[model samples]
Target chain A: MKQKTITQSLSWLHTWSGLLFGWVLFAIFLTGTLAVFDKEIDNWLRPEIPAHSLDSREAAQTALDYLQARHPHARTWNIGLPNERAPTLSVSTGEQRRGGGQALDPETGELLQVRETAGGGFFFRFHFTLNLPRLLGIWVVGLAAMAMLAALVSGIVIHKKFFKEFFTFRPAKGQRSWLDAHNATGVLVLPFHLMITYTGLVIFYLIYMPAASDALFGGDREALNRALRGMPEQHAGQGRQPPQEVAGPAPLTALPPLLAEAERVLGPLASLSIHNPGRGDARIEVRPLLGNRIELTKGQSMVFDGVTGKVLRAPAESRPSLLTQRVLAGMHFAQFGGYPMRWLYFVCGLASCAMIATGLVLFTVKRRRRHDGEGALGAALYTGAERINVSVVAGLALACVGLLWANRLLPFELAQRGGWEVRVFFLIWLATLLHACLRPWLRAWQEQLGLTAALCLGLPLLNVVTVNRGDYIPLEVTILVIGGLLAACAWKIGQPAPERALRVRTEVN
Target chain B: MGLAIATGLWLAYSGMIALCLGLERHYKQVWGRPPSSSRRRALRATGWLALAASFAASVAAWGWAMGPIGGLGLVSLAGLALVLVLPYQPRLAIGTAVAGWPVLALATLAG
Candidate 1:
């Protein structure tokens, strides 16, 4: 094959593979991008959920008492202890009635807080898998990440001007405009792209390549886990709790003392988890979130043997290891980089979506032209693939952004807010796919892109109207980001006919 | 809890299977001749084993900072870097430098 043949084949491969993974990639990028501000958003969304409140131990125990009362025979209990990020403590009793996990309140044991939690960690969780069941979302994304890695490799292999095109972006010039968009998205945010893809794959490396364990670990995941599970203390249970009745909550340690000692010992308790609270074995563990004034924390658990108040094994405190992981966390989360980095990542993420978006558009662009000589069977197959691309990419964005629209419209006190949020997301996406399928190619692109742009542009206004933040409150950073992106989209979708842009640029030259 | 994790497990299973299919296609596309059917089968079998191994490693890596998959991310990032170098060998030295350094810095800050 001629070099041109190689280039074309790779381009063919990149375009199609990328289109296949585009929606998932966009979800991953968007969610992952938002996940960079996971903490900030958590802070923003759940303003009612107090920060630096009392650790979850007292709360966890209080929750545990209720859950234990509800289902004492549960084989196991898991308490989602809370801290700075989420003040609401949640408790899960084992085998309550069936396998289904039951929810409980932290304080007062009055079934604390549960309404369609669209805010807390919902956006964070929504990324990668669109909050699908773990297996479904993870696999879809893992496969996409693999495809993305392949596309990245093939994209590099095929680009003739890899270096010359570095940092070169020319606005609106036919396919050069498209190619520039691709190169700019890929290269300018090269670090973000590379880091995200690599980290994304690594984030789920074992799931994607379990063989690495056998070859790498020589067997026995437990021992390997021992090496890595940072705080062995967390796993070592606070001695066995004897049987307990609903004590209607007893005197628990005042959170203020715990906080002070916790800070003195563990460097400001970022979070607290209490198991079997208000019992003989009621355990309280104090730990830092991002440790005070010293370093970004990779949490350390000093489990207090509930009855004795003895510290458990705050083990695996390797400064080097912790620091390395923090950086990885930083790169992945975009926390260390702050607002500028956040915006950079957000843009990069959008660019990543744009990369997929443009790549998907390019698929149709290449196909719509008069096929020089490809056969009908080949054309049909190609056309079918384009159809899926249109529905999946544009449709998927419609689903995601539409969920935000849904959040506004959905009854706030609805019993299943989380469920409804997810449902609306899928429903919107599904509708888009169906609409794309029903429409002509050109119309599908224009209309869906137009709606997406409109939705994105209007997101901030909707938030302002629904959430009713005072004008005194500056623009929510997230809303501002969305507004900018939506405007960009509206511009892209509403750009004049290609011939016009070409004629204008050509005439100018 | 274990059953809930099974979803992630199945995901691993599907990815390995798809990877086999993808690699088979990729090799065929590259070499013109199809990879031997038996070889593809072998790759599938190996892929399963790799999937299982990586799963265990990930579980182990949990909570350990550069824990399970993060290490893999580091390595894969490196591998992908090498793959991208093929089309621009002259720029490799500079390219790797430009790419590799930030990761190194992140590793430092993360630690």
Candidate 2:
């Protein structure tokens, strides 16, 4: 095949494959970006969910009592402790109402101040769901993940100058500039590209390649879960069972002391779990899972029998799968944690988005000179694509920022507040896309971009309109991000040289 | 069915403009000679509108031609499909598949 054919073939591969999975990847990027401060966002959303004053054990005791009393037959329970991002102590007694789950006051047995607490879980779930049907979303996202992995690896192989131009970024070259941006972003954050993609696959590995089980353990979900989770059931009945109910109000140890002791022994407990706290079978599990700060992607969990107050079994950390799963999880979630690593992942994540955006631009840029070499028809197509690229890229930014604006501005009493917020997002994007397509290339580019810039630049001022989160909420971070994005957009459309380089060259000729 | 519905909706939503543009898109793909006549321009416009409308009609008739996943879902999968059919891949087919499908689907989901 000719060099051009090969490039064309890659182009075809690049174009169709990219459009297919672009949206899902976009969601992942969007959500994952928000997930960086998932906890903080959760707190911002749920103002009423109270902080836990009592220790994990105290909260555990109240939550346990609620669970045992309300959902004695629940199959499983999950307790998430308060963190820097979220102050609420939460308990899910059962999957269903019958199974009984509620967030309880850490000190009092009273019901938690619940107010539609979707919190960061919304973004977490949106990562997988893409707002599609449940498991379907997973499979779809999983497939896209594979595409990303392929794109990363193949992109490197196909580019002979991958190493030669590793640091090359020339802004005035139009399409060359987009190519540089794509290549630079892709190459510079290649580790992130690889880590995020591979890890993302692992994060949803069970769904993506359920065969990991077949290949390793013969396709058994239980076997896989047990193997990955490290033989949880085996240790369950090693000790004697406590009574079905609390044996006459046993005045257990105060939670604060237990928490202090647990912190002392386990080292500032990362996550706390409560199991059957009031029932004789009640237990409090203190999780010393390594956070993003430290490095424990494969978590280490310690179970404390609630009634006995004895650390039942201290299973020294066991083996975790090093195969794609562990390593991928570590890389994807930055689970082997730390602030520095988190920031690193965050930067890489943003770069990954930049890489995609650049690729889109490059697709148009390479074909850009066709106006002169190719003719008016070529220029027209170029103009059309340019409008689209602008719409999709900057349009998406506008929608995102608009959503934040809606969150602040939408009156709490507004019926369908959540739905309306979502609707507003789509409506704005649709309108922008339409507006972009209607204008001529240059005008559309500048105007749509200008609109995007205006929205972003005005965000900080918009926040100031409400005394709620916008006014009282921290502005420095929001201001910087919004300002930075607006500046970048402005530079892209407003900068004159890249678009005019060819014209000047033609004139010189 | 989901994909079909989505495709139909997209066409319903943005098809006319995209198709008219896409018509020029197809025309621009021709090698050597550039199309210049008024007749050719009208023909291209009509041709593209037909194609876009047919696609929308197909989805409308088929209810989910894009598969259960939806039309946008097909976008990423189409990338994989093209790779499968394309000859002389630079092994970057894998990378294209890797980066394209998910990125496409992710953006679709956001929409």
Candidate 3:
């Protein structure tokens, strides 16, 4: 065995680790980018909610009136206010604060007959969880995020001509072009890559690294959460008790004034929940919209007395340490700076996906040249790796658009339609892997990318035939642009072979 | 706000072009000649100045808190656009940057 220099060792680490985790990272990045417009996508998925310009207070009152009449005995009544981005008021009755809501037309106060679909929330969930069980998915994604951080650091360490090749890129040179693109995208968007990855890990910090929690709190997550909220530890083991029935139902206070006061304080409201609705001891908790600030106020709320409409507890100001954590999480969440900032995050995320995809392709391109020198086993492994690369990259993209197609194409009255949509997504992805394994490499890439392009380009027509709404023009336009790009990529893949690339290089020289 | 953001993006693009041209290899690639030391120094200085102005515009558009974050993204994307364009259309890359001066002036007056 020969001694290896630090750069050589780290270079080896970078290549293998990146290839091992690159597929998962690509999925995470692609879905995270889509999650940037989750609300808009949600709106598109459920087109029953028409776009409207309703005042928040008026909408809140309407939701209150509706909930009061229908769910008078419910323990908690939640009302999701319509906003500029999502113009659908939702009211749900449940023991929990969130989950299982019904959409309502804010103008008519009637329940909307919306079809069940997976919505853009699937992407947001899969971004962090990879469609695995909740805890298991988080751990898997946490490992992938760590691998990304490792790759970024080692990639910088091994690149000898960092500054000299800052803006260098040469097309039509095959392997060199891939390396250049990998370097350019990775380096140019380095800040976003680092910030997004680090913050993603920070979001589940205690779960990923529980040593501090274990050492201090004996590994009791509930106790740690109680202490963080400044709650007394004596009540740590006691779970939330269902609200006891009062002697008699009483008239609740008018919600418009409370909504006004809350709006004055919290900027714009997203939703409000009333505990023990119509009971004498009722309480109203108002939560602000997510994008009002860079710090995620996920659990922050203003509590008010239901009878007197007086403030019981205003939203707590995060301490410096908590604020730092929240801001970092918020950066990854990207719910601040309105649409423009979200667009920036989306572009950077696409670049990140491109960076990972290029790195994966570069691995195979580099290996293909040396495969003949290696034995039969190595050649077989190389072939397997190449097929896996195609399936993971192009396959996942096809599955994503296929999910949207399923939302529209599937039977509207079908039971559990959302579940079926997700199943369609996975089935498409699996089918792509099989196709890639069976077909020739170029044809596999060309066919899958071409199908994805056709699906994306055809989405507007599908929406028209099924949903028949003009509100989602922006989403359709964006899909069309992506389709055009994918078509270009498919065309390029079909045109260029290794021999042609070699010939072009020779001609240039 | 729209004018401010447009100015920010244009200046960021122009700044990245200046910085790219300051590098001797990129300079030769675009202009078919290597830049002298003084020319390169001037280009680098101009690049930094344009970037600073772009930061100001970003701040004007998004305010102090989110300004720097968005500004960095603008500059990075501008650099990325420059890199991708230089390989395929080197003349158009520099040509657009050079043409941005009038647009920047119009944005300044309107803003």
List, residue by residue over A97-212, the lDDT tens digit for candidate 3.
Answer: 45368888888888989999999899999999999999999999999999999999999999989989999999978789999999999999998999899999999988988998
Worst 10 residues of 3 chain A by lDDT: A234-243
Off by over 4 Å in 3: A97-99, A231-249, A496-509, B104-111
Candidate 2 per-residue lDDT over residues B10-96, each given as its tens digit: 332232222222333323432224455674566546535643554554445334421211222222222222322222332343344
**Which docking category, incorrect, acceptable, medium or high, applies to candidate 1?**
incorrect
Using DockQ, give the best candidate's number: 3
After superposition, candidate 2 runs with Cα above 4 Å error: A1-12, A15-24, A47-79, A91-118, A212-220, A230-249, A264-277, A288-300, A320-324, A371-388, A414-416, A441-449, A469-475, A495-509, B1-111
> What do the candidate models score in CA lDDT, each in turn?
0.56, 0.56, 0.88
Interface RMSD of each: 11.5, 15.3, 0.7
lDDT of 3 by residue, B1-111 (tens): 777887898899999888889999999998899999999999999999999999999999898978888898898899899999998999999899878878778767866
Give the alpha carbon lDDT tens digit for every residue of A1-509 in model 1: 55567778897888777776765676677666566566555444433333334454566556556755875654345555565434545555532222123334444565634335465366677676667797788788778888888888898888777655553444445666667667655654455566778766655555666685677677656545455554354353333444455434433444455545565676534445555555555556665655232234544556665455555545346557545544554456544322433444555576677677667666655555544357777667666666677767667766666766776677778887768877887788778777767875545766876687677667667766776542313335555556566556656655677685554344223
Candidate 3's docking class is: medium
The per-model DockQ list reads 0.02, 0.01, 0.80
Candidate 2 lDDT score relative to the true structure: 0.56
lDDT of candidate 2 over A440-503, digit per residue (tens): 5555656666666676677556655653332225433654575576667666665667547555
